[model samples]
Target chain A: MNPKPDKKIPALYGGIIMGLISAIPFVNIINCLCCTGILLGGFLAVMFYKNNFTPGTPPFTAGDCLAVGALAGIVGAVVDTVLSLMFLAIFGDVTQQYILDLIRNMDIQVPEEFYELFEEAMRQEMAGFAIIMNFFFALILDVLFGLLGGLIGYSVFKPKGQQPLQPSPPPFMPQAS
Target chain B: MLLRFFSPTFLIDTVVMKASFPYIVLVCLAFIWCIAPVLPPMLAWHVSPANPLSSQLYTWFSHICHQVDSRSLHLFGMKLSVCARCSGIYVGFFLGVVLSPFLSRRVSLSAIKWWALALLPMLIDIALDVLGIHSSTIVTRVATGVVFGVNAAFILTPLIEESLEKFIPMNWGQRKQGVFYESQTR
Candidate 1:
């Protein structure tokens, strides 16, 4: 019997998809809808893994889906952090400027102290420690959301009333004269 | 029909309650998750505005939410940690989970189809707003978010319960067989 296909390649593909959606500016907005991007990644990973199954192999289980999703999430977190840092280097905190523009456009009253605090927080956010913290937090969320996505994938893709393959009987031999 | 729907006999099933322990636990966790974002503003109001805890909460939520103050709901003169749409989604999810047991368990639509239907309105609203066609108000944002959230809960809860049922028994059987064989060998 053939062994089940390795999960790493599919997981990597899923992670790349997650990273691109999460790290890209403006595109990352989709994630605000309950981490939809991360979920999609995990779901796609399960789909890819399911495609690898052949007849006679043990059917993929929910536990397998969970593990693949979590691995994808870890990879995605790394990719997202790297891409975000690269964007930050190029764009110089576009998010902060966007927020300032929004506040200005809204004409909301803000105390000067709030501005000071916001700037202080922004400064700290750019620091190495903050970036690492952000990565860890993202990792936690990605794994959780990914697991959910895996469950959804399993429900959608599970074969109806699948049973184990029975070994075929050996060919009957004719009696010799 | 409405009265029957609200009746205690219809609403509460002891067997379902016993069977749905995981679902109940999930609902509680979701409640906590939804409430976390709201508490920062309240804490800032009741306690010092400069409270580190509130700031921490805001910072934590910022990862997941754009949190544009203009687009967020304000309470106690402070913006929520998440946007109005996110707030609506979270609240609606909690409501959906609470109501799931009483609602019909049978699902006619597939998961992807259900998700697409749920997301359609939000996508249209966002597209229009982005194109400078129509600006989305807080009401529109919240309404769309709620639709998506409610649909998501209805789809996910049953699937999760089913998966748990499938996974738990296999493990239980293995453990039981292993114990039996070990005792027989002894």
Candidate 2:
């Protein structure tokens, strides 16, 4: 059997899905539910990997899922950061305006100082330090959550009717005669 | 008296403790995770010098949560590191972990369905707010979050435990491969 298919393709597929969901404005709200979008990406990666298995291949294991999930997470984090930068370049911080409008519509009474701090932070969001920090944190969270998703995927997608290989019976021997 | 050390009871006790090491570690990590969010607000309120640390935590959590001020619970005049919904989830998760010992250890694939069912309330709450059918209050968010979290803890903990049992012993390089695989098969 072909050595369990290369993980890169599955990881890339999962990463792209994660990045798009996370970077898109409005669509990203799904992540607010415990980073569900990222988790879904990891789960999909494992699912894709499981599809690669064929008869006589090494049986799927939890470790394989974990490694693929983590790789996808790393790729996802990079994709997310790049796409976020692209969006900022094109839309010019629309997310900041969106938040401000949301707060106003909700009639929340935030302090004047808070507004100043928020605006200041938004302005600095494009800076090198902030971008690096964001990537760093995103990487950590994505990897952790992705690992969890992989484990869940394993539980759900484990192969059926696959039993452990029993040891061969002791060789037949004739009694001394 | 020395023979007592080799007794079945003593041997079983030793094996059990070794097996439980990973579970204990997981519980400790969960406790830390649950408590981390509370520290930011408490530190901001009580220790002026710790403001930087508190700010760091808020920043760290910001990625995972929206952290809308009005939607969050306030402690010591400062908003929590995460929103009330997230807070409820964490608290509920901790409670679930603590209580999981009393729950059934046999978690089947069907537990996933129950976990999904638990998320229904939260989804409905979000959908209502988004559709302008009804504005979800803080109580609704927290309540739904708690339900989801508890179910998540129940479903995921056993899976994690089972996986760890399969792998952790291998890391120690002690158990024979045939014996290990045989145990897993059983």
Please count the clashing residue pairs in each candidate, in the order shown.
0, 0
Task: Candidate 1: list runs displaced more than 4 Å.
Answer: A1-3, A86-123, A160-177, B1-17, B131-134, B165-186
lDDT of 2 by residue, A1-177 (tens): 668788889888888888888888778788876788899988899999888888878878767778788888998899899998999888977877888777767866888898788889888989999999989988998888788778667756767664321111222222444
Task: List the TM-score for candidate 2's chain B.
Answer: 0.74
Q: Model 2 Cα displacement at A158 (Å)? A: 2.4
Q: Write the per-residue lDDT of candidate 2 for residues B1-186, one digit (tens) a residue.
A: 567556777544443333354455566778998899889989987888367999899988887888989899888888888898998888877776655554534334354576678789998999999999999999998998888777677766655655565665442223444567889999
* Worst-scoring 10-residue span by lDDT in model 2 chain A: A164-173
lDDT of 1 by residue, B1-186 (tens): 456545665444332323344555567778998899889999999999999999989978877787988999999889999999999888888877665655525446655677788789999999999999999999999999888778777766655544555544433334556787999999
Clashes of 1: 0
Using Cα atoms, each model's DockQ against the true complex is 0.15, 0.18
lDDT of 1 by residue, A27-80 (tens): 888897678899999999889989988886778876678778888898889999
Which residue pairs collide, candidate 2? none
Quote the positional error of residue B81 for candidate 1 in Å.
Answer: 1.6
**Chain B, per-candidate TM-score:** 0.78, 0.74
Q: Candidate 2: where is the Cα deviation over 4 Å?
A: A101-115, A162-177, B1-19, B106-111, B128-135, B165-167, B170-186
